[model samples]
Target: MKGKLRPVGSPVPFPRISERQELPWAALYHTEFMGSGTEALSLAVAIAIRRHSQVSTPEVIIPAYGCPDLVSAIIAQGAKPVLVDLLPNGPHMNDVGVRGATTPSTVAVVGVGFLGIPERLEELSGICREHNLLLIEDSAQCFPPASASKPHADLVVLSFGRGKPINLMGGGALLVRTDLAGQAEEAVAQYPVSVLKVGMKWLIKRLLFNLLMRRLPYYVLERMPLLGIGETSFHRLDTISRLDLPESVLQAGLRDFQRRPLIHQRYDTELAGLEAWGWKCLASDRSEMSRNDPQQPVPLLRYPVLAPSKDMRDRALAVLNSEGIGASAFYGRTLPQIEGVEAAVGGRDYPVASDFASRLLTLPTHEGVTSADVTLIGRILFSVAES
Candidate 1:
């Protein structure tokens, strides 16, 4: 692990030229690809706003702790983002908090699947039905995603960014249910299609990106402060365009979906004794929408764990990074603490989300992570806890 620097996640490798299969989800829902997950979310929120136009000032409920892009999506549609606390030490929203936050103006509830852990969409859907609110499943971090003969949520958002489950460099998808197909399709038709131009420039850029992903080059790049390797910042989403996907991108995503489960298994087995060290794995037996499906377990974008305390979490993070393992405290702060988002979410105290953020740390589980990396990560955690 001397000269190598593993990134927190790796992009899906470029696929070999081959016969392309039709994107699988297309058969399941009315799907539309877009420029980014943020754009896809913006469009979904827009549709919800229009459908609930009777509300004078529309509001959308979201978990207090998540990507600032959540706020960006809601605000882009001129809707207020009502932040709700998460279930204690959990990735999903607290049921009571979500219910308490709802009001006459609330138009939708965004359920985020954090680090590939699906939210309890079945229960949330029941809650939404009672209130006549739209339910949006943000599956940006999930793999082996939820789908059915019928749509699971009113809208489902998927991302194909650098660190996402299916990294296509940059793209996202919005799946609209049959009920909302008219509005969703109408909004989609307004944007010009973004056809990825695969040429010398694209080839060179792709090659360079793959090269930088290597340990030594990434180690050097990680030291460059201006690069801001792991910083989380918010950018206002202004445009939404449909993506014209190529067969290669689809093939690559398929390969990624098929390969990630083994990596997840390795991490789970290697990190088995975490509780003995006072650390806890977050991948517990939480119920989700896919509970009844034959495919019971799914791969997480990263394997997350909670340290006994924030001090121990910080120390273990340093040790993991020093050993060249890609470890991170994902979104180290709640949305309101992020610079550009405070005005939107205001200065509310989300005690649960704050505690969750402080103790959280995630390990790499992508295709690039080796067995030795998992072993080393476990050893380091044990060492830190024992200290």
Candidate 2:
């Protein structure tokens, strides 16, 4: 019998983005966000502080269990990241976010769309003005026109990375306000282009996963565990590894978007059953409800649940991945624990941050996870709960 084939994953090209095409803004600011959107957004934060006349280091708020790269980005720019807890039930910046944003040192706020769960963007806009800080919305994981959530911050960054609702394996766009446009373009011009590998990896994924992944073996290929190649997919802006991208990548994205375009809707109809599946969603906190009366339905990211024990998350993620569906402790644990973040907060874990981190487990959803897959995962989680 022939030995099993190694699970050859998607290749490198600039990945598809929120739209099938490149962002119109990318033509304006052509830097590829190395590795993660956090890097790019943080860079925007650094740029925002440079405009301030005061020499005081800026303060920024990052959701407690989010991208550690984000915290590092803040520090690199001579700023402090004030950690905020997630909204109790989901990956959202909530009242805790508001509280964290209140500090006088806050020069900006970073918005993360956790697991594709879109945060309230408009609220961040208000937070920015009240504190006179720049609002740098990180739509890294979520696709957006930033419609309902509108914070006319000084700047914003969106990614075209894999697993992001729009699958652009390698690039992102930086959006600065009209006044700062010229300044941004000049500064970005100083930044280097994307690496060939980065572009190649993304292009491969788009062709492989988006275009042809469905045609391959549904089980044998997708479920091949341990055919694993150790690789760092996300490029940290902290290093000098920033790659100069070919203009063609940007042009491809812009053109594709105009052709197919990404549109955001509430959770998929098939996944609607999930809302009642004991997945306690983090709706807006009471304070948010009272203020602005944000009337729009919040975007649900992963169906996160409190694990029965410290080990449940790992066990669950392993099971889901083995079954060939994406699963993550996603945030892993509280930011205070990460080597990078520990340095930032001086190593103290707040109750909300610690508990939320420990208890949370996220499961992937989409029209992607089949009925059988959902049933399988639901059963496993339910079994874990019962056990």
Candidate 3:
């Protein structure tokens, strides 16, 4: 492989695109968010609480298996975080751990749906409502068709970002299903939207995608007299992808599965040799979004599952990255583990989420990591494991 210089902050496009794939539901709702998905979810969660609370602080329960954004959202809103670990890979919560830590101040339970795994939406929703607590579903993890149930959540936030179920350049959706929806909208709508930001995001997406697939002009590639700008040259809302999306644009163009690489079959071929890759498969081959299977489809962005151990996981990662296949030790540190959060949860444990964070690794399956690449990666991993 030839070395190309890309600035530290610049994004390169997917090396290839297959056109046959089923699009996930979250993509279509990206642009409608008032701010980042975290911001939107924060607004929704805050609105779910009542005006009068005697406690010095408000608090919400967050499972350990989550993006750091949840904690950031809590801090931004002046609320406290209650961290609870989740079950491995699946959306199951360690309710026992949660309740053990639950305090009288616990106002809400945040549930994030997971890919291929059934979300604990219904059960968690029931528990929250029964305990007179609010429930917020972070649909960023679980995309539509993957939603376990139309959860009876007080709030549900969706993400339409990179590799999300939906492939919008940038956006999140703030959904309020309970009595709080209208109130959340009022506050969210108060924030002014940015046109300049959205346009830039669109351009960066197009340019990045074009260049990676070798569709862009060679001048841009080499950054020569006509196009010598490096990836680090710009970071403005007008110059790069700031990830701002509007609702209308999303409804129309987000997550177009019809785009190429609908079936990243080449990826599967490369990685099929692992001793135990723990791929998350659909419960059924039926399409979750289309209501019926389409002729061509893009498989799920990630294949989430529990691996044997941390050492094996790291070893596998080393092998992949060594081969130029980007891999991830996903959500490595579960949010609920923070001291500020543990104090907030009243003392619940999040075994499941903890396990998930420690073990899950998202591989470079879709970004033109071909079947041959998979073979290369697998051979590396096999040698490492055998060693």
Best-fitting candidate, scored by TM-score: 1
Candidate 1 vs. true structure, TM-score: 0.94
Q: Whole-model lDDT for model 2 versus the true structure?
A: 0.54
Give TM-scores for every candidate, taking all chains together and pairing residue i with residue i. 0.94, 0.69, 0.69
**Which is better, 1 or 3, measured by lDDT?**
1
Q: Model 3: per-residue lDDT, tens digit, 1-387?
A: 333212111122222333333234333222245445666666655565553156567787776666666766665666777666655455466767667756777777787665523456667767776677777777774444333234366667776555565555456667655345454555555456655244566667767654553313322454465553321121112111123444445544333432434223554444454535543322223244322343434345554434567777787776665555555665565554544444434455556666666666665434344456556655775576566
lDDT ranking of the models: 1, 2, 3
Candidate that would win on lDDT: 1
lDDT values for all models: 0.81, 0.54, 0.53
Q: Candidate 1: which pairs clash?
A: 5-215
Q: How well is each residue in 225-316 modelled by candidate 2, as lDDT tens digits?
A: 66432221222345422444555665554444333311113223223343343443332221121111355332233445556455766676
Q: Please give the lDDT score at residue 138 for candidate 2.
A: 75
lDDT of 1 by residue, 1-387 (tens): 655546455655676687665554565668788899899998888888888889889999999999999999999889999999998878889988889999999999999988878888887888899999999999888754564423568999999888887877888988888667886766677778889876677767778887888788888888899999889998888877889877776687777665554466786687787788778888755433332355555567788898989999999999899888878999998999999999998999899999999999988876678778878887898889889
Window of ten residues with lowest summed lDDT in model 1: 286-295
